[model samples]
Target: MKKIKYFYNTNTLRYEKLVTPLRVRLLRVFGFVSALLVSSALVIWVYTRFVPRPTDKVMEYRYNSMKENYATLKSEVKTLQDQIAQLEKRDNEVYRSIFEANPVPDSMRVKLIEKKKELDKVEALNDDQLSNEIANSLNNIAARISYQRTSYDGIEKLINNQEAKLSSIPAIQPLSNKDLTRIASGFGMRIHPIYGIPKMHNGLDFTAPQGTPIYATGDGTVTTAGVGNGTGNHVIINHGYGYETVYMHMVRIKVRDGQHVKRGEVIGWVGSTGASTGPHCHYEVHINGSPVDPVYFFYNDLNAEQYDRLLKLAATGSAKSFD
Candidate 1:
């Protein structure tokens, strides 16, 4: 260690100790602290950026599951589509050709082909992609809506009463993939979440955020669009041909009674208004005014496993939060 040197004062003839200046001491301290902070910041950045986060792992797992499910759905859709095409071919060869009636235009078939191309291009859809895919599909549907009401109104003149060109019934989902949500509860008998008693749940409960848009599964006229018993702010559509769809627990209703709505048209939003559980949509399908399983009819784009899971979830979901 070096000792501090002292200076001798000739006037007083005394030894005086040499001291460092205040500014220099302060600068040294500031520099050390600045280096330490920089090193710590680098270490944190490396750890957070390089290491896997929990959310990432979970998302990866979900994405993998969705990919598998989507693959299965794609196959099923292809098979169903092949069956439909075969049926249409049979209709044209055996039925339409006999009367020399032209089958539906290739424009509609071309749209279907475009949709299939879009579906094939999607390997796995993330949340945003899934939302967009659904939105685009619905928008496409809305943009190219035919064979719904216009076909039914003047059916005698359209295609000589051909059933192949008409898809008037509710064959698709009221809530498509974009608005698809986790099952809150399902149809059939279950213990009431609130009342705590054995009861029959007439619809599939979809857990969604407030203000999530709800759509009409098929082309229909709004038969009922107001608050009802137990269900809050509900909308019921009459698809004719003895088919009806009921959407309950709406935050807001976009249509009024007697108003016509096409498939994929927005009608309402998810809400916790009526029976009072949480934000969700309670959906029901009816045939001749009798409630039927809504889950069976949502075959718009779900894979088999996803559809099966929906059925399973409805069957095995907890008996809670139905209103």
Candidate 2:
């Protein structure tokens, strides 16, 4: 180290110092480096304490927000599921009522059963299931709705088909409020009174006195009402829905061809003009061009018990002529 002397001039406010050059330069450099280090340390400490870190509070807040969103989505899914169940129940009731009113086709019933099974599967799901489960339930509901729409389409098609077929066939009672005892012969294989051999009897014979009133069986147009030597004053009515009825052995025909007639409307008077044994009305029901027993036509007029009884009787009765 070098010895240094220093002097001060107080009047001029000036200071003077004498030292070795190398030692003074080293001390100055050391002081400058020390001050830089102190400043850097202070900056680092302030940043560490005052500013937010990269992966701490921000990440926690984001996690909580995600959880809240998931909860809200789950609740919405549950509400939608409940609504679907209610709609399915209502649809089932409507389908049941339709079945009670009219016979359900086999194909429609099968689809309904399939929908019910899908609904059952949806109902079995738990709330804790993932989003995929909710999506699956939504898909099933859409499929069921599609199936119901298809079922309605099928029913409409069936109705249209039936109506077309019924336009050609005859199935209705020929008269209303007339004495049922006037039926002298019935349908089935019977011995022809004239031929004395087995013959197919297509209609019932109502033996009424000449000039007894005859009525239409259902709403229809009279297709034909004229003389047929064998049937004797025949009238063919075309009722919609695969139904047609024939009225024969009439004394006077009141309805013309293509004339619309309602059920229970007088269309003629009973008489024996054809190959008749007496003055009677021969009524027949042809369903889709095939003859069914005329007794079945009266089914609509019977109550449930009476209809059942009639069915029982028909099931057990011996084959008899409905000539």
Candidate 3:
């Protein structure tokens, strides 16, 4: 191969020809290109080893932050689960006490037992060992909600039972004060006014003038409010829950059968209409068809001193007939 070169002399303004090898010039160009490639490779390698790329640094930082956040969330969930368990235990104790105080309905008791089983199942979970705190918290929350609902149901049942019991008790005076004057006769063994023989008396007799008011002992329905053979002008009230009150020897009946009567409501006036010796009210309390002392039932309305005095009087009093 042939090569040509030119030289210039500035002072003489002349050109000169020089000789060079074509192979040598080709080799020199190849060498320069190779050196340039090697330098580029060195730069790339240095960048990959030490100088971090923007996208790579961002990705690394994001991964580390995610790990830290996951750890914190797991710890918080564990704490919440512990608190829930404690609250559920306390609720169980309260419910147990309420159940003992007032018997729970069978259906409610079954539901409460089921809720307790569910709580036990949640407590038995060992997911904390596997670091599954989220699952544990979710289960604990569900158990707590179920327990709370069951407790509310128990309370409602207890309230309903108490209300029923309270409704059954006689809480009002059977006769008005105007109609309740002196006692014409006492309860227990007494001489019958009409028969003139020793007999059992199951009620108290109140002497009052005619046209006096007679009140109901409690809220009830007037089952029978008319004259009978021996109890003329009678009023029988069914106060529910195995309690029945009888008002005999009334002057005149004011309420009809099947009439709804409230506490302190007037059913009749005072009178001695039947086998009585004088104008008076015959008040009696029958529990499940058996007569009980009416004075004991009125203890709730009496003060401490009044109740004690009345008890003393009852202990000292003897069966005497007003006739």
Candidate 4:
């Protein structure tokens, strides 16, 4: 059923049925729609402000997880950098000393300040940028490790060669003289038996029997195994590293012209050959073609007391040279 509303018509002072204007009805409907829309918008704004969506919660969890992971990764990177720094210090100070090489310069290593500045920008970086930064740091460290390994390889080679050099040096007496009694004439000026004048005796003369064995003083190849006008049946061994040894006035040469011989190997026998006056052996050590005192090279076989006694005997003035 439709209900009609009445209104007072003041002009006629009587009650009449009211007929609302089309404009007023339309305005009333517009007001209701506007109020409803405003209320709905306010409720939606409050709900979104106080409550999170499922996707938003998941995103928040992921972000927090990523931050924790980044912190852990940063700590690990710092530890690796510190370890590498320690390794570099050891490599420079300790390992380089083995081969007498100069240390690897600090300039060749990573620049800490530059790397720190790059890493400091991590807080502002996105996930991808941070990942790239970490990767780059790792690559730099790996490259340094590779370089250090190569340096160690070179040091190893140098050490091996140094060992060989030490082994090749002349370090023993030419003949066995444990009692220190065979030195007949020492180095320096002596009266020549044949010339009857003072002459430079370039080697030590050891008085031994005619068949006494003479030994090589070092590891080397025999370069001379024949006779000389003044040296008799002599043997010259060429030990590398600017060293050579000669055994002169031998009765018989046991080594060939190019035979390789070791220390203490018999290379000849003592004899009074050439200008020699008695059955003795003359031994000399040469460095780069010039003769040095062979007495100094006997360190490997002599102790302190024996060396001192031998030094005294070799320095004693003798009246004549055996050869």
Candidate 2, residues 168-249, lDDT tens digits: the string is 3333445542233344556667677666678888877766678988877677888998998788787898886667888887
Instruction: Mark the 10 consecutive residues where model 2 has the least summed lDDT.
Output: 314-323
Candidates in order, TM-scores: namely 0.50, 0.53, 0.58, 0.64
Which of the predicted structures, 2 or 4, would earn the higher TM-score when compared with the native?
Answer: 4
How much does candidate 3 score in TM-score? 0.58
Model 4 C-alpha lDDT per residue in residues 173-282, reported as the tens digit of each score = 77789999988788888999899999988888888889899988878899999989988999999999898888998999899999999888999898988878889999
Give model 4 RMSD, 1 decimal.
Answer: 8.0
Local distance difference test, each candidate: 0.76, 0.71, 0.73, 0.85
Between candidates 3 and 4, the TM-score winner: 4
Specify the poorest-scoring 10-residue window by lDDT in model 4: 102-111
Report residue 159 deviation for candidate 2 (angstroms): 8.0
lDDT of 3 at 253: 94
Error of model 3, residue 46, in angstroms: 15
- Better candidate number, 3 or 4, judged by lDDT: 4
What's the distance in Å from true for residue 232, model 2?
Answer: 2.5
Shift in Å, residue 154, candidate 1: 13
Per-model C-alpha RMSD: 33.6, 9.6, 10.6, 8.0
Tens-digit lDDT string for candidate 3 (1-323): 66677888687788877555799989999999999999999999999899999998987887686677568766766766676676556556655666655445669888999989867876876544323544565567667766776776687677687776666567654554422234556567877766778888887766678877988877788999888878889999998888899999888999999998877778899887877777778888999999986767655456667656554554444455433
lDDT, candidate 1, at 124: 70
